[model samples]
Target chain A: MDDQQKWRLELQNSNVEIRATAAENLCLAGSDSVAAAVDLVVACGDVEDVQNWAAAALEDIGAPPVDSVDALESLVSSSDPLVSYWAVTLLGRLGVDASRSQVILGKAVSDSPHPSVQERAAWALGKIGATEASVVESLKKAAASDSPRLANLASRALA
Target chain B: MFWLIVALLTGGGVSGLLNPDWPIVGPLVTSVKTQAIEYKNQNPLGLVGGDAGHESANTAGAYAGPPVQSASALGPNDKILMATFNIQVFGESKLRKPEAMAVIVEVIRKFDVIAIQEVRAKADDILPRLIAELNADGSRYDFIIGPRLGRSVSKEQYAFVYDTNRIELDSASVGTIGDPADLLHRAPFIARFRPRTTDPDRAFTFWLVNTHTDPDDVPEEVNALAQVFQVMQTARPDEDDVILLGDLNANEQQLGDIRKIPGVQWVVGGGVMTNTRQNKAYDNIIFCAPATQEFTGKWNVLNFEQEFNLSREEALRVSDHFPVWAEFDVWESSGAVH
Candidate 1:
């Protein structure tokens, strides 16, 4: 119907390049295209390439959609580490403004199976600066993690 | 009245003013000394090894051992203690561990000035709580916390906390390095401090460039740190004493670009591991040996596990990294004792 709607359709297209191009175009649209990019990322499901591209587009957008925090939170809790990584990274970029996602990020710090996902989650929690007792406890556990990378990241967040 | 006049006439007035035992000055000096002694007694270093009123009663099993001296007690009178600690994310998580907090306080109390790294953005409550705990025993301390810094989405803050009675921060001299090339992930934070000693001749000042390099970008940031140190040294030609301290994330063998600087010395060398895990020498207290002539050659890692009698797991909970410290004389120039 409109240019943004046209790009959203391309995002659903079976073509990989088309989806990437659509994601890039949405990024170029900046803050105006946040809702569509968020929708693309959420609806794209387990499509790693499309989700990754859309996540990067959201990162480029630089601002979180006011209503998209729930979708991003759901994405962060994804069992897939890549999806969790990209989503948590995007939340980190959003900073304290994404306060609603702090608890899930804190949980992911200690619970996430992948080190990178756990690291990103710890980083996001630090960015959020959440003061909850549970959040602090989760980070403390992660700080003593056997994995040096995860421990270092958790330590940085605790520091 | 006659004695007072005679005392004033013979330049005794000046001597009397400086004398700690003089009737007018005696009470104030005694009061300060009393306070220091009281603080030391209340928060004894050996308290960590005992069943004190610590919050970690359940988790931290009782420590039974001889009272070991604190790192602060080992320094010579003429020298001030300076330390750099990578406090592992120093935020809400650390606050949640009260046993860890107690051990941290004991280690920190051993230094007059400490440069803290990895302060998370938005965790402003940690420092105030620490200061409150430190001052509960009557020790006065103040801090200079910098703005959020880093090259990533998750930024951090650098802070300098000093004993107000021993050191005075040069408020105007606090700033972070500006990296136009973006070589460093987090620009080093610089601050100047003067020893709060009455002997003007012995009162000296120095600059501290505090930093924590990205682990992945250690080699480049380490080299860039040398450049930053050089620039900071030249920026303040009047102040020859400059110390760079933090979690370099690289040992002496890996200090690629930093070792190239002339007169530079790594006080904490590769032989010493400054981490609680005993795996890495991530923290360091570095300075130009020739320029900082006041170095007393006294330094050590604050091993909480051994010193505080903490279990390996409990110790790691405090911080995977240990504090590394060095002692430096208060005098800027070599001179006969007054």
Candidate 2:
């Protein structure tokens, strides 16, 4: 495999530092890094260093491929806060293309224990701008939440 | 007209014109007030917040139905508004939105010097464009941006945008704090500033360490910041008014060891939330209460959503974090004047 492919595989390496270095390298590769976006997103659940680089790489790429949408949607419910956060972040970056993930994102907003995840999910819903009744209903309920950040974002989505 | 006054106050000669790259030091004092533009013509949609249609809106520009005050009219050299705002992902996308850009400009025009974080862009147009819009009202403003920093490829930069007519940036003092131990996600961007004053020695010269910590690594980053604050304390023998501010990602009680600094105080207390959601206080302006006695005991979190009467989504388009500000005296309280 080519060096870029090798680095993409390194994201699944056993050593956290090696994985982090790989992610950082791919991130610096610019648009050439888009091919590694999915691996980078998966690595976001790793150690803090690795997760940070992976998340940054993913964010720098702007959006992952549409084929990775299902994987990202499932990861949004990951128990780890960072995992769910990055998942929602990437899905949100997908904008309207990730419309299919709204139900999961809505569930994250309404039921996720992590406030950050909930906040991102709420923000994602607004970015998606899906008019589904369930999506609208979830945002409406969240608008009255005690958490001002969540309520603010949900209200913004409704608007 | 504002640039002329800026030339006098900052010693930045009028020959420098309005270039963002022009050095902002030197003195030329003129009382020419900025010519007021009729908002009715420029803001056709009335989204700029101060015309007849939005009279009741509580925006940063028109917080209480106040008239559209010229940037020169904020007061000469009596007091200055210092603020911190994390313009969420400020880059090309946000720049494309004129309405969002207008709100951003309005909020910034209200402060003398605003520390901006989350400037994520590969190109360098963000700050220059912002400066252009700010000066669109004939106000003289300039910006100093640090190198892009972070552990990942999507690095972010820290910037300080100041109204040259009211504040003077010590360009020589601008640099990022050294972090050999790698304690912060983004090393703080440090710079010094002084207000426009008749007595140069009495100007309240102080250092600002602008930072945005990693959300996932709060406790550790905050603890390191405490050290950074202490280092700043001894960095300069003459300056003790070090106001460290930005999107710290932690509230008052959660600031970890930074609280251990003797007499260190933050302007935005537990009662105020900095995030747009209004539920979390993720940003603040911190200082040594004893050293910076110039603080006027006034502070606020400018809620653009409520002030501009924008939907939460539109507000988020401007930023997820609201601008937090604290007022301070233009002249040094404990300096040569005393």
Candidate 3:
């Protein structure tokens, strides 16, 4: 099998070490490695340890995986906090072009059960820099939230 | 580990260990190796220009006695140095890097008081270790750390480390802001301090509100800070001199509502960058003007890279943020105090 197929197989392996190793190796592949990016998005949905390594790999990639935006968008709602955290952060890292995900990010900011998830969603919205009225209203609502973490993030985004 | 030892031996001895260009030895090992190197370099004789360099010597003919009238001519005892530093995450990540601690200690020793931020809840050992290190030279240094605070589950503590000989802490006045409005992520901690001085005319007390605002929440937090400031003032009705210092995370222009607070002066200004990366002015020392005229106009952003002769990355490994400081005379003055 090719390097991509080898990594993909490792990602699917039952052993956590094998999956983590594959994710880390894929991260080392850097931003141009679309294959690594694709596999990392798949791994982002895996168990927490595997998911963390995969998300870190995606972060190391430092650019949005053009092919993985849809997958990331879906992962933003994952029950796992780590998965949602990485997904929102990744979306933010994608910048203004990822504006299409603003609605979901705004909802995550307002209603996500986890404080970290809400914080990241607010950060992602700020990163997207959407000036739309709905986006502003959502941030305003979040800015007034009782949680200082969420409020601070929403205030920053609005600023 | 072997390569790190070799690098330390060949590159300027102990100081070279903090060189950012040193080959990556993985994050965990790097912290361990850096600490081991610093431990090896520790000297009892006191290395050249350690604490001694900070001393101010009077000119041969100048008056050396107390009650030095001019603020410019004030000696170290007649002046108090204060600093604000975001030591990144001062926990296990920094614990193993003794070289960084050495730099941190050296920077802090130059000041009478320092407000430190980003102290992790899990790493309570770091402060005791730091205090022990600072007191090793027979200097009496103590710290008051606030409870673990943050809006999120992940939390950090704020602390004030001061030289006992130069300042006295009002134990009763120590408390964190109770944010009923829920405006700030981490409510600032207020500590009242009275400068130790024999000259009763010069004795003055001030409240220090140590804070580390979230970068994302600068506008709102900065605005809300005015409320925190007002509450602190109300708590200590007699003290009008209140100084806000820490990683404000906002520049002067971005101060939002904080800028509107009348008579407030941001001492560190002109777009000076305080981060090791040289991109942001994330730290500040702001005080209520006219009330705090003891300010000596001397301010600095301690650049660890330039001071330690280390590479930028090495400095960052110590801390991404640099310490910003301002000097103040122990004596209160009326017009044009330095």
lDDT of 1 by residue, A66-89 (tens): 566777888887766555766777
Clashing pairs in 3: B20-B314, B295-B338, B296-B338
lDDT for each residue of candidate 1 in B15-92, tens digit (9 for 90 to 100): 212111122112111110001121223232332213332222111111111122222343555679999987755665
Q: Rate the local accuracy (lDDT) of all candidates.
A: 0.65, 0.72, 0.67
Candidates sorted by lDDT, best first: 2, 3, 1
In terms of DockQ, the best-performing candidate is 3
What lDDT tens digits, residue by residue, belong to model 2 across residues B157-256?
8888887666765433555766654557688887777775555456687889899997645786899899888887765456778899999988998999
Of the candidates numbered 1 and 3, which has the greater lDDT value? Answer: 3
> How would the docking of model 2 be graded?
incorrect
Better of 1 and 2 by lDDT: 2
Model 3 lDDT at residue B94:
59
After TM-score superposition, the amount by which residue A94's alpha carbon in candidate 3 deviates from its true location, in angstroms, is 5.5
Please rank every candidate by TM-score, starting with the best.
Answer: 3, 2, 1
lDDT of 1 at B205: 71
Candidate 3 residue-wise lDDT, B68-171, digit = tens: 12232123767888889988657654566788788988777877889999886354455767777887886656666777776544467788888765765544
lDDT of 3 at B79: 82
Q: Is the docking of candidate 1 incorrect, acceptable, medium or high quality?
A: incorrect
